[model samples]
Target: MPQSELGPLKSRTPSSERAVPAQELRCGRRLSGWVLAALCAALLGCQPARADVCPSKDIRNNVTNLQTLENCTVIEGHLKILLMFKTKPEHFRGLTFPKLRVVTDYLLLFRVYGLESLSDLFPNLTVIRGNNLFFNYALVVFEMLQLREVGLHSLMNITRGAVRIEKNPELCYLSTLDWSKILDSVEDNYIVANKNDRECGDVCPGAPRGETLCPTTTLNGHFSERCWTQKFCQKKRCDATTQFGEVRVFAPFALV
Candidate 1:
């Protein structure tokens, strides 16, 4: 990706030397990595062109063969389904989905990438059974007023999305949404700070022991170091012992 100094719309390189070495590219004259990815997405027509009918194969089938779903949305509308594995679905740069309005259930769904703040898109969505977001950076920024359940593991699991948890150190509250059921078993994974930013070391917390960076999540949010630790640090009263990495647990807030 090229680094644009002017704006979002103008950091493209010349078509010649398309395979030029990225490091060798002239600074201030190339697009940033993010911009480059977006350009490729545009050139390849990665986003959906039209609403293709979703195949009726089991959702799990598509999970193993993401190659088949390069041009369609997953399950849409009112339905009850069971997902039972950890699968990383590919996200087309300009993917779109149908407006969901259903009282559905996604039980035992292991991991998902693009299902960000879905509550806003599906006002009637209720009862999301056993599942973990794992990583969907855009979801961290979603406004799911009714979302009460999330099952994210480590920060590494969250590969992309927009909630901006990257710089927020005091961010412990993963979601402001309210769901009837949410599992809190992921109180032992390390959370990653703003690893993408150059100034991250100054604002972000020190990395877990033995590691040079914080635990990984879908690291796109602009959260502070305090906000990140405070939100996910476990609140259990156990024998405090220094562990190898940052603990993924939350304690009650006390302004000390």
Candidate 2:
């Protein structure tokens, strides 16, 4: 071959230019790794955390089951206490959750044989952000035969659902609680049924039928119908009447 045609062996291409492809390859690999890690993080963030189901078989023998429940700040699913026949109501005397703040789903107490009241269980629970599991009820207490009180004094909000108190024959205070004060608005979403009539004042003396009669009184020659006709009436007070006729009677003071 002619020397001119061979062209001086193409003077070994410059090292810097040769290194360009290698550099680009290394950068591509690094970018791919970063992208993969970012995608993984995004997926993890989108997924809901697993729920904590309490009252395991060991609950009767160990306090750890209760401790597990206490440790959760947010429960992603239902918090159900059902069929707890072994654990008596007295056993729950000291079971309190001081740090629990939210339940993202329904808080159900169903047929818990001995659970008398939830008065002390979750003292700090402030929110039940319902995920729509139990037909729009964030808190459902059903068929709890011995349950006497719906002790949700500290529960201030139910973000997305109603409250259902049913078949709790002994739940006497159901008529007295001011549900509007706790929830943002009741909006006719509360259902209280199959409870004790006398305890609920369903039949107070000289009261209209079907009305849960609270104590009546006369103030300053006025007949004030202090009754709890509506289930959500927080305070038991005599309803104001147009009749101002004077009548001698003894009545208790109705505190607000």
Candidate 3:
């Protein structure tokens, strides 16, 4: 990946001062804070993009462009860092978006082979409003072959749309979260084809009272795991309380 650091903001010399060459040019100096605001707000999407602003288009690349998002706190659009191929997890180890708090649209991660977890990359992300979605889903993590976890530890709410996480061969920490804690409904969400929970050594620690952390339900009618993570797995029983809010957390036969 090329080192594409953000360029320094330039000062705008007024047209009236053009005749005075001595005063008209002042290179290397940046505009004041108010002028910088005008530079972005006055000509939105124009050149010399703000270091903290997300790209106007969907974010994509093999490198994830961690450099471009130097001070970003809120991504107004979808946040999709994808297709980081032929790389190891450590390439992005020390790199992170520590200031990011919300992705107003959706978030998707696909074919990121080296990424083992998201705990560091988006450590402060609290909400994904899902104003826009990818195939009717707000969060999609697919084909992450080496990923071991969906480690968004600070994620608190996904206010709209469903989740789709599939085809992650080594992924864990899926059969532990209770989506009911975040989403209004888990009926349409899909979580499948990750490492089998039975074989996954990192299976979620059950509830504190020695009860099952999550209700027994088939993931997309196959893998016998329910919920999304351990923190979301607060409800410990699967009897008359099998339903976590509006989510039917058990197969019809299991409920029988």
The candidate that wins on TM-score is 3
Off-target runs (Cα >4 Å) in candidate 1 are 1-57, 61-92, 104-108, 113-175, 180-256
lDDT of each: 0.25, 0.49, 0.57
Candidate 3 residue lDDT tens string, 73-168: 567678777666777977878878776766767887777778888877777666666666665677888788888888776665676677878788
User: lDDT tens string, model 1, 34-137?
Assistant: 44435446676443222233333224323334333343322221121123233222332233222221111121121233333222222222222112221211
Q: What C-alpha lDDT, on a 0 to 100 scale, does residue 111 get in candidate 2?
A: 66
Which of 1 and 3 is ahead in lDDT? 3
Q: Which stretches of candidate 2 lie over 4 Å from their true place?
A: 1-64, 184-190, 200-256
TM-score of 2: 0.52
| TM-score for each model | 0.21, 0.52, 0.60
Rank ordering of all candidates by TM-score, starting from the highest? 3, 2, 1
lDDT of 1 at 45: 44
**Candidates' RMSD to native:** 21.2, 28.8, 19.9
Error of 3 at 69 (Å): 2.1
lDDT tens readout by residue for model 2, 36-136:
33444576543222323232211323333566676655565667666556667777788887555556566876667777766577655555656544545
The better-scoring model by lDDT among 1 and 2 is: 2
Off by over 4 Å in 3: 1-57, 203-256
